[model samples]
Target: MEKKERKRIVLSSNTAFSLYNFRLHLMRTLKEKGYEVITVSPEDGKYSELLKKEFSFFPVKSLDRKGKNPIKDLKLFFEYFLLFRRLKPDIVINFTIKPNIYGSISAGLLGIPSISVITGLGYVFIREIWLTKFVKLLYWLAFRFNRAVVFLNSEDLNTLRNFSKEKSFLIESEGIDIKHFDLTLCKEAKKDEFAFLFVGRLLTDKGICELIKAFESLKKEKPKVKLIIVGSPDEGNPNSVSKGELEKWVKEGLIEWHGFQEDVRPFYCMANCVVLPSYREGIPRVLLEAMAMEKPIITTDAPGCRNVCVDGVNGFLVKPKDVESLYFAMKRMVELGDEKLREFGKAGRRLAEEKYSVEKIVGEYINLIEAVLSKS
Candidate 1:
């Protein structure tokens, strides 16, 4: 009698879209290769259909952004433990904060093989030392048991290395689908008024406030310059910008806020440049998408953002949270006019093709997963 192949895989993450989009590709790809993929996330309407159609969905009560309660966190821990025991997955892949910490812990308890991807070290690690220390300890303990720890940026990989003796691997930003973000489809940008686009959760840590302040200041001198802000407030995130504050910016006519849109390519297409002033990132997907679209960029010189923009080449790099620096960079892009900006955009597209394409990144994930399975 032939022994049945045992290859049950589990993927856990807090962000619905992160699981649905980037990780979904992996799930489908793996399933096609004959592995059963189970997805765990905060059950939401957005993912219900896909879960029903494609994979086994496990609803886990997670701290959704702002609703952080210690009691609730405890509940989540138990929930994770229960799920792990029930699934008895041969391999587990965890992403984001809560999952990476609690999920890894649960997997360890069950003696399950696990892999964790450090997408970004969020607010907890970026703030005061006490909290940072606490979160670092969680990472140290949880990550120690994983088969592989994947980082999106070199700096993050180095940081993880500093904290522990574990060998960590690096991947280009959460892989962008090059075919989906083709530059050939982009309309020629306007020559007179240069458009600067900001996309991401409307969070303070993402530098939304700073970007708004800088845009307001620049508009005084360059009235013809336009600013477009995409993405909705992440109510769960502690650092999310208040709806009232964003409304005030719109009321003041400082910039155009498009709320949330399912498709971002049109916004990217119409813009001359992409800008992100985030305090930190684990390699922002927006920058990768913009570059894939052949758009010039302006972002802070912080670790992850720096990975995409080569100062003065593909785009300008400014100091994070420095309104004046961001404003000056915006002004300089305007001064460079359309031709120079197009050249920069062309360079950016080439860089994306060479370094950050989806094929390249997905290949890395495939290699990592195969290597882990080989050992198992």
Candidate 2:
């Protein structure tokens, strides 16, 4: 009898933080099932250290996350090409815009099967500037060479349908660890003042300004309400909020900014409600975490965000970027009282178990991987 060798899988993303936070479960499962998992991304501060501790981590120095330098992009493409050629992975799975584009192209050039996960359309599509057309063109080229495309929401699939003729699948999200984020884990006593937690990058597209405005208005009527923001400014993103502006809000006692937390479970445990007024997302992980922790939510009725909540069931949905609509939703949540809010949280937990559990999502990925590999 001959010994069988495990297939090698390369997972590339924009940042190591994304790979660790979003795809850790999938990577761990793949390793447990006897596959070599390699992670490729830019070294993202402490997150790179975290990823390095778990699996083989490759730092792509040429990948300028938000830069438009063609020379740097070309270098990144070559870096992926050489890396894939040397490692000779059975397959490559890419996330985020740049990784999807450059990584898929490089993997295709090496005749390795690749899957691009469109985590979210994000800024390029939201702003629709000159770079938007360029990115779309690159996406069309990369996706054409890809074996499959995965979307977190249907809207993103529909939006990019014309870009790729390949088979596309919607996975909802990366999926939350229902057990790890169990409601029972949240043992912290609720504070005297009602606290609303917002977790994500402090970017303009995240509706940070609008959230602040709405909270400012809500605070006048209900002095007991508190807004806690948990995220760091993305310096690479043009839409990122200025530190000065954030400090001004904090100085004014409008928000409690706790930047970049490795563990957000405590914040979730303390929060009365979770809010993410994002303009759009592939699917907000924060919402999933909140749901797993059995916390009520309020989010924009935008693409990815809408998929998480059924209006008036688990939480309230407000119009995207509409300050007044957001304010009203927050006001409604406050008025719902503790009992109704608890009911909402319980409903959210049910939804998380049914739809967004890590077990179910990992099964989907395993199935997809098997099918893709068999055909290849």
Candidate 1, residues 95-190, lDDT tens digits: the string is 988888888888988898788899988777566668677778888888877888889888888877864455588876767888899878766654
Candidate number with greatest TM-score: 2
Query: Clash pairs of candidate 2?
Result: none
Q: Write the per-residue lDDT of candidate 2 for residues 1-376, one digit (tens) a residue.
A: 9999889999999889889988999999999989999999998778889988879988999988889899999999999999999999999999998999999999999899999999999888877799889888999999988989999999999988887655888788888998889878766574789999999899999999999999999999999999999998999788999999999999999999999898999899889999999998998989999998989999999999999999999999999999999999999999999899989999999999999999998899888887888889
- The positional error of residue 198 in candidate 1, measured at the CA in angstroms, is 0.6
Q: Which ten residues in a row have the lowest lDDT in candidate 2?
A: 182-191
| lDDT (CA) per prediction | 0.84, 0.92
Per-prediction TM-score to the true structure, in the order listed: 0.95, 0.97
Model 2 segments more than 4 A misplaced: 188-190
Whole-model alpha-carbon lDDT for candidate 2: 0.92
